[model samples]
Target: MPDNSRYSAHIGYLFNELPLESRIAAARAAGFSAIEHPAPYAVPAADMAALLREAGLPYVQFGLRSGDASRGEKGIAIFPDRRDEFRANLAEGLDYAEAVGVRMLHAMAGVLPAAEWRPEHRACYLENLGLAAEEAGKRGIRIIVEAMSPGAVPDYFLPTAASAREAIAEAGHANLGLLLDVFHTVAAGDDPVQAIHDSGETIAHVHIADHPGRHEPGSGRIDFAAVRSALDAIGYAGFIGCEYVPAGVTADGLGWLPRRA
Candidate 1:
């Protein structure tokens, strides 16, 4: 049965082969009230909203695309040169968030340029983050910067919860929070529970995938029970995203979790 009143599982791009409406409907069929993954921008907001409402699902939070801005490539937020472009993309992303009535924004700060390892690169990232904070604050959107594993996202400015925490701290803003993913946490060598505890006030959106291969919870080595306890202890109340690569059908792989209805 499906638990009508419980935690929502965030489906990812792994299930994109299905039409967006079907995907949202299937998530509802499987008993989750929300969805996540790459920004669902291709589908018009009104249309997306209609499907979600019909299925009784909430359009909780989604990603910010990171690609080329110059020559059509458009990311690497916080770099000195990309600041203006990044802000434009941020504003654009915020507009999508508003359309869905989302309270939090899941952001990929793009990769830091190769020079970010240099002395001057540090200042550039901090200054740019300040602007991002200001912009997100204006829209009442909580922007969480994600940190991926080195193997996953090599040059990105935020590559671990620790680094994300430090950078957000340095930027010194309340709206800026950490978008922690368990798979990346394991890849980045972080204690998943401790990372959330460490982030304290800044841990916003969470993406949950088990490790070894980004499979659905319980399909990989992560102890979801422990992780769930950690979130419960912290009084965290946000979508625990299932941003995993499907081993089979996405729902079949994740249906192991307990459901109420």
Candidate 2:
């Protein structure tokens, strides 16, 4: 097992084949101190809270409800016409974060309409994120902005770590920060270590998936040891979320987990 203290099971990907409650138990059994989910809005807050308590696991992170995935809306944060919808989602996200005792909330940036950047869209995103950051600050939750890869989420507005950092800065809120996913960094043809070095303290959370396949850590070309070294170099203390699809059985792919010496 990985050192439960340093790692979090992203149940959304790890035990995705199982039901929610079962996944919670599976994380506990696998020795994870915490777990994250993509969205838990379908589950009642009380029920989700009870399950986490039962497993002695802390809820580390959860994402805001991006608009319809089937309809190709990756997020509403950057959609100028969806300002009201984004506000409603933010309120729901804050409430859910409080109920689940989670400290971080990922605010996904929606896909670009023309597969290119738009000034108005960036403006709308900053406004929406600033509002969410204030609300999140009140609830002791940090708002995370993640950079999506073009291949996985084509036309995504924030497609690079630098862009994410810029958005967070322009939002001008203490609670706004970056969700640095190493897989996305490498997939974008950038060095994951340099992204880590650049992100530094603004990194509120980290996600792990190997490049070329988006599979478990050891199943692809990423050198997680170097990633670990960079994280330590930057004094990052947040949970390292194992957010990868397994090539086979999930449990069978956990050998790359960092066990404490």
Writing each residue's lDDT as its tens digit, candidate 1 over 1-261 gives: 122344455555545567766888877776666777565777877887787778887776775656654543224565567666667777877888788777676655655556636655667767767776788789887777778788666666677889888888888877888887778998888889888777766778778777888776676778877777787778777776667778886666656755544
Candidate 1, residue 255: the lDDT equals 64
lDDT of 1 at 199: 75
Those runs of model 1 whose alpha carbons end farther than 4 Å from true positions after fitting are: 1-6, 69-75, 112-116
Which residue pairs clash in candidate 1?
A: 2-261, 3-260, 3-261, 67-74, 68-73, 68-74, 69-73, 69-74, 111-156
- Per candidate, the number of residue pairs that clash is 9, 0
Per-residue lDDT value at 84 in model 1: 69
Give the Å error, residue 84, model 1: 2.1
**lDDT at position 205, candidate 1:** 73
